[model samples]
Target: MKVTWVWSIAALALVAAACGGGADIEVADAWGRPSPSVAANGAFYMVITNNTDSADHLVAASSPACAVAELHESMMNDGVMGMAPVGPAGIEIPANSQTTLKVGGLHVMCIDKQAEFVAGDTFSVTLEFENAGTVDVEAEIKEG
Candidate 1:
């Protein structure tokens, strides 16, 4: 009986290990373009790494530096390049994959700037994910 119980416990532990678990979402290379005080908007970029077994969504973003923060995308429309908001649904980060927020692509649009985002200036932005929760990222303003 003792032998059988020990074997059953070992099997359960192995199964648990194989199932794995959720991993924290990682934000890296956080940066933003320098904007003058007169400018009403700025752009932020970064790489989001999803290390979990399940996929996640970057549902929202916010910052104290701007009156409005939103996910935006740039694309060519009928031969004319145009930029637009990504909507409230937000962007997706696949499981075990990386999503990059870059210029001329997907990015965080900081509108109605409360201060100038000049070179060397830093600010914090909160990224809200569907499963990973909220993460605070410090973004530096500089030239890429």
Candidate 2:
């Protein structure tokens, strides 16, 4: 009985260790707006949730559906709204928090799209992180 208990405890410890001590970043609710027929640019939005003890950065993004993908942030000056690139470092997600990429906020810019963005369409976007590595998520295109 004692030997069995010891082995059980050791197994549990190994399991916990395997799953702990890492930046756990998750992507959810990823969606994009349907682009106009003659538009070459599009945008993607989603929620990035970080559940780890340390902060992480979304370094990059890519998709075969677009010629280029970049992280961008919206800016407003004197009631004029504009946008700028978020740079190659990408957006940061603080420890144990969530960052949302919305229509007029932070978003993924798709340049020279390979196809038209139509409603009810889905595509894959691979996101690279500083700590969590790469994650590929399917993004749904909808009319906005």
Candidate 3:
């Protein structure tokens, strides 16, 4: 009876660990807000931390609030600022490292807004990764 009980507990623990029972990657202070007035498109910023000792890449992103969702990076050319889509290569997050997606750098650009993103509201963005797979994160809208 004692041996059976121990096996049963071990089986339960294995099942729970396989079903995301362990600690997960932590994402905090994720904020996205519409650009100031006159800006047709807006950007989203967040910090992704990889707690595990495994590498990950953010490959794609999608949002219901915009007609088009893409990973973008800002650049300067001849004193003019421009934004362009990230190519096939995805953003890499090394093991035990944090990647910050911020303004004037790398961000998720929501184009052709379907509905205005308001502060204090939350929206979902699905992020596909190479190692970590797909992670759906709730982005809080805030005033930038």
Candidate 4:
């Protein structure tokens, strides 16, 4: 009887995790730019919310739509705005806070795009997190 009770508790825990009952990370507002047919580069933007007491980091990303996918930040230099690649550690999301990846800020830079991005098109981007493991998000291409 004790063995069965322990197994039931373990099964319930697995089910809760599978349903995101213990998930500390949440993604929303995932979007990307619709590049011209001749363009070879694209970008993605979104909001990442951390609800847990511990912080987390977005370590990496993968997508079939781009040859190189990485985090980047836009900065102003000498009155000119330019983009630079993020560090190996990637971006950080504080506990009980949210991170916004938007234009003129933090965004996912997709270089050497496999194909041109168009309106009404969607693509998958798998984001690797420090504690959340991997979460795949569907990014919608829209006019920016």
**Local distance difference test, per candidate?**
0.90, 0.89, 0.78, 0.88
Q: Where's the lowest-lDDT run of ten residues in candidate 3?
A: 20-29
What RMSD, rounded to one decimal, does every model reach?
A: 5.6, 5.0, 6.5, 6.5
lDDT of 2: 0.89
Candidate 1: C-alpha RMSD to true structure equals 5.6
Question: Residue 91 of model 1: what lDDT?
Answer: 90
For model 4, name the residue pairs that clash: none
Whichever of 2 and 3 has more TM-score, that candidate is: 2
Q: What's the true lDDT of residue 80 in model 1?
A: 94
TM-scores for all candidates? Answer: 0.82, 0.82, 0.74, 0.81
lDDT at residue 119 of model 4 (Cα atoms): 89
Candidate 2 lDDT, 1-144, residue by residue in tens: 999999999999899868755448888889999887589889999999888888899989999878999999998889999999997778999998999999889998998999988889998999999998998989999865
lDDT of 1 by residue, 3-112 (tens): 99999999998897566443469898999988788999998999999987788999888999989998999988799999998867689899889999998899989989
Evaluate model 1: give its lDDT.
0.90
TM-score of 1: 0.82
Q: In model 1, what are the clashing residue pairs, if there are any?
A: none
lDDT of 4 at 124: 96
Which regions of candidate 2 are displaced past 4 Å? 1-23
